[model samples]
Target chain A: MKKYLYIIKTTFNDSIQYISSLFIRFIGFAITMSILLSLWTFIYQDNTTISGYTLKEMFWYLLLTETITFGSKSPVATNEVKNCIKSGNIAYQINKPYHYIIYSITKYFADTLIRFIAFTIISTILGLIYVGPINNISIISFISCIPVFLLAVLITGMIKILISLTSFWVEDSQPFQMIYSKIILIFGIFFPIEMFPKIIGNILRYTPIYSVSYGPAKLMLSYNFSFFLNILITQIITIIIISIIINIVYRRGVRKLNVNGG
Target chain B: MLTEVKNNLKIMFLSLKYNLIRVMENRVSFLTSVSMMIFNNASFIIQWLTIFTLVEYIGSYTLNDIMLFWAISSGSYGLANILFNGANKIPEYIENGKLDAYLVMPKNVLCHVITSSTEPSAWGDLIYGYIALIIFNFSIKNIFLYSLLIIIGALIYTSFVIICNSFTFYFIRFSETSEILKDIFINGSIYPDVIFNRAIKIIFFTLIPCALASWVPVHLIIEFNIYHFILLILATNILIIIAFFLFYQGLKRYTSSNLMEARS
Candidate 1:
């Protein structure tokens, strides 16, 4: 447990370095938020609400989506796997002491932290201007929900790595990575899976992405202990399944690899 | 001169063929781009349908007028994208030191970059635009006017994108400029010109000049505004001149850094 904590601390430091180095990226993100928030505010000015979401609720939802999105390792995880395979770095990884998956998980955490800070500052300012303070949720819920959100992030990361490992067989994994991440963003970040078609909704109900964004967003809004437990159980089960699949694919990819470094 | 024109046409066709072949060779990137287009067009149709359902009409233009506006906007988007996708990413090329490849190429550097990226997503918009045009059943006069408007509109936007992209040579961070340009062209141009009164309309026409991109052209086609018809020709020439000057200025500032260093 202490080792894991140390690993996390080190990773967090690395993420800070990354954010400082690529400072322009944060500025770009801030501008993107302003554009989106202003556009939503404009639309909301005409129609007070859409569905059940008030202008305030809509703003909060946007903030929530943008804030949590910084934590999405779904793309980076895939990119790491694809680059590793393409450059034959997977062989070097075999000799390393740390697990390859741990490296991806930690990097994602660091990336998310920087994104979260930028988002918090930007959203806080925009939210104040547009709709005022976010909903008054309980402190208990806020504190308790942290783990669930982290669990959600982990699930997203695992799923991305799983999709990325496909590149070990195929020459290029970008198409699969793009389609996978889009599915997660559109379904997970933008719209709740419940709003999707009945067939897709049912199929995705069992997926890890459900635990990542939808389940957490719902929990943040309305907390039912039973529903929370169900989400937690779902994430655990998905993680186990994905881990098994990764191990199988990793071995197969190792055999198929030409071991030629670019 | 005629033979030169024919040769240029042949080269353009060959370039298009080469572009398709290059994209096809990298199947993943092509598929991702096409999918992005599908997603974009789908969302656009849904959003427009929602807005149209709510509003009756603005100005003399009715729902059909708005649909024609939609079609023209969509067509301009596709045409400009096909023509100027490379110019769009000039900042990145300049910043990341990737512009060297184009600068060294014997043919026109701007042409190489502009033709380098063919967004499959714009193709979806192109199809949708034609559909919208046919559905609106524009009058003969309106059709002729709208066709001319579309050409001018594409030129205005193409020049704007080129000019914005050239700014990357001076400013290291230009993604913001492109983002702002996108907002102006994509979302800003959609509303009827009548939404703004005369003064604001004039500003949109002559200064920031978004109306030349869509609103003025579409409005003139339907309402037969003589001033705008004349303004379109003037706007086209001004935009072309601006683009040429900006590109020339940016090219002059460009230090011929080695390709390897540029990649870094």
Candidate 2:
């Protein structure tokens, strides 16, 4: 635990070096948010409600999705993981006392924490100014959602690590990364699962992708105690499953590397 | 001057040919990238579909009109990236002193640098754009008009990106600013112009100029407006001239990193 804490501390310190870049990226996010705000404003121009969301609710929904999608990006971890496998750099970490996966997870968590904090602040201000307060959100629900949001971040990191591991087989992991991101964008980030066709929405709820994005955002929008409990349980189960998969995959990959003398 | 232009075109052609061959060497990777881009581009249409299903029109744009808008936007972005892909890499090149090679070349450094690479996924955008046009309705006159608009739009997009990236010469690390500016321009181009207020519309026309990339072109196609067409042509030319002028002015400030590297 202490080792991981140290890793997180150092990673956070390193991330501070690129504060200007992060600020610029936040500006990019603000621009995207403005575009969506304008778009949804236009869409809601004729009707106050479409598919059970008011104009305000729709903007709030977009705000949550954008925040979650942008905040949890771990580009440094993604690049490191891909390069480690591609260039056989994993060998250097393989001999380390600490686990490479844990090290990577800590670095990713640090990066995500910094970005999420910055994005939350910016988005909150923007939301206040652009859409005003979301009346549906309960104070209790908002407080309870802290753990859920952290789990969502973890799930996101795990998924990225899994994608990056594909570099062992493929020459470039960028295409895989692109495809996965698009899938998330279409199904998870852009539109709420509720807006999906009934059958599709129901099926997506069963998948981990729902827990990663839609579940958290939906809870923030309109939280039900029972629904919140279900989301929490689902995310924990998914995290466990993904962790096991990562363990198996990483171990086998390392073995293959050893055999191939990579 | 004519002979010089001819030689530069030849160099560009060869560069594109070689880049294409190199990318195609990994057939699976190339195909995957192209297919993924197509899917990515197509997904945005779903958002529009969701909107139009609820409302008949958005700011005077019907579903068909919006489709035309996307076709022009994607086609123009694709052509710009395919022909002048390295414009996107200018900040990185300038930062790492990679422009040294282009400086040594006899060709126009700006043209040589921008035309040195081709993006494989842009082909997907180009194909998808035409597919959208076909869905709207295919006609000879429309095709001619679309082709001309796409060329002008490509010029605007490329020149805008080059000008933004050339800021690296003035600022030591302006990559982030360049990237954000380019993203804003591209994102602004994707939406209908009617959504923006008069002030933003003016800014989009003059400062960022995303309207030239998609909205104005789509407008002209939907209704032949010679005035808007002439305006777009003038804007594109002015942007190109500005891009060239800024690039040359910045060239004086470029202190090479002196890193030993070669362009493949």
Candidate 3:
């Protein structure tokens, strides 16, 4: 635990040096959100709400969803595992003091926490500038959503590790990761599940996309106790399932591992 | 001038052939990458399709119109990426002094630089583009227009990318910013032209030039106007010429550190 804390601190310090990249990404996200705002504005010109979201809620919802996404874009942390496994760079860590996945997760969380904070602040400010404050949202509901949001980010990270672990079997697992992210992006980040057909929406709720991107944002905008309970439980279950899968995959992968290095 | 043009094209083709061969050496990775990219691109269609289901038209675009827009954008992107993936890599090349090799050669610097690399997964994009074209709308004239405008689109797309990447010379470590600009260009291409108001639309047309690769081409597909076609061609050519000018000017500032590197 101490070493993991050290890893987090080191990774956090390392991430701060590249602060300009955050600025650039914020600019990109802000531009994309502005475009979405325009589309939503055009959308709401005739209608009061979209997918049960008012225009104001739509902006803030999109903002929160995208912020979670921004926080989860730790591809370097994810890709490093795949590359190290494939390149046999993991051989050096065979006898490391700390557990590999735990160390990696700590690093990923530390790195992305900066991005999450940056994305949330900038996007919230932009959301205010674009759509004004969410008059209908309660402070309690908003605060309550934070744990679920962080868990969502963690679930996303674990799932990525699960995908990355496939390098033990496949020639390259990066493509699967790409496709998975796109699935999450389209189903989770871009729209509320309410936008989808009823069957698809229900099916998506059973998947990790809802937990990773949508559930928290939805609960924030319009807090419902039952709804929050369901999403939170779904998220907790997802984290458990993915963690078990990662442990299983990692164990099986290590059994097949062959490394030749001094 | 004609002979010079012919010689440049010859070398460009040779470089492209070799680049393809090199990437294909790992056939499984190559195949997987291409197939994965196709699926990756195809997955993007669901968003717009879902939007269309709720709203009959997004701006002036219909359901079919949106599909056609995607076809144009994807095909254009695929073409630019496959043949001139190096446009995106210009910064890395310049940063690493890999541009030094191209300079010593007698070929057109920008031409050779861009064609010296290829992205095999872009073949997926190219294939997906044609697949989308066939699925969305198919006719002899439509095919002809697609082929022509796809080239126009690819040219416009590559030109702006090169122009974005050429900023490596003016600003040290400008690679990330160039990458962000390139992302904006590619990502913005899917949206309809009507979405942007006058101010931003002007920037999209002039600075980003994303519309040339997508909305304009899709619009022409819907209703081919000779005047619009001519202006599109004109704008694309001007962009390419500007790309050439900027590249050469930046080339003047390039200084190689004599680092050891090899390319097969």
Question: Number of the top candidate by TM-score?
Answer: 3
> How would you class the docking of model 2?
medium
Q: Name the TM-score of candidate 2.
A: 0.94
For candidate 2, the per-residue lDDT at A33 reads: 84
Question: Mind giving the per-residue lDDT tens digits that candidate 3 earns over A145-255?
Answer: 888988888888888888988998887888888988889889988789999999999999888888888888888877888998998999988888888888889899988
Relative to the real complex, the DockQ score for model 3 comes to 0.68
lDDT tens digits, residue span A1-262, model 1:
4555666788777677666534454555554555455545545556765555665776566566655665463345777778987888888987677777666666666556655665556656766865687576688877666777777767667777777888877766766666666666566665555546579778878776677777777776666678778877887887788889888887898788778545
CA lDDT of each prediction against the hidden true structure: 0.67, 0.85, 0.85
**Top candidate, metric DockQ:** 3
Model 3 global lDDT (CA atoms, 0 to 1): 0.85
Misplaced by over 4 Å in model 2 are: A136-139, A258-262, B257-261
Candidate order (TM-score)? 3, 2, 1
Expressed as tens digits, the lDDT of each residue in A76-98 for candidate 2 is 55888998888787888888889
Ranking according to lDDT, highest score first: 2, 3, 1
Q: Tell me the chain A TM-score of model 1.
A: 0.81
Better of 1 and 3 by DockQ: 3
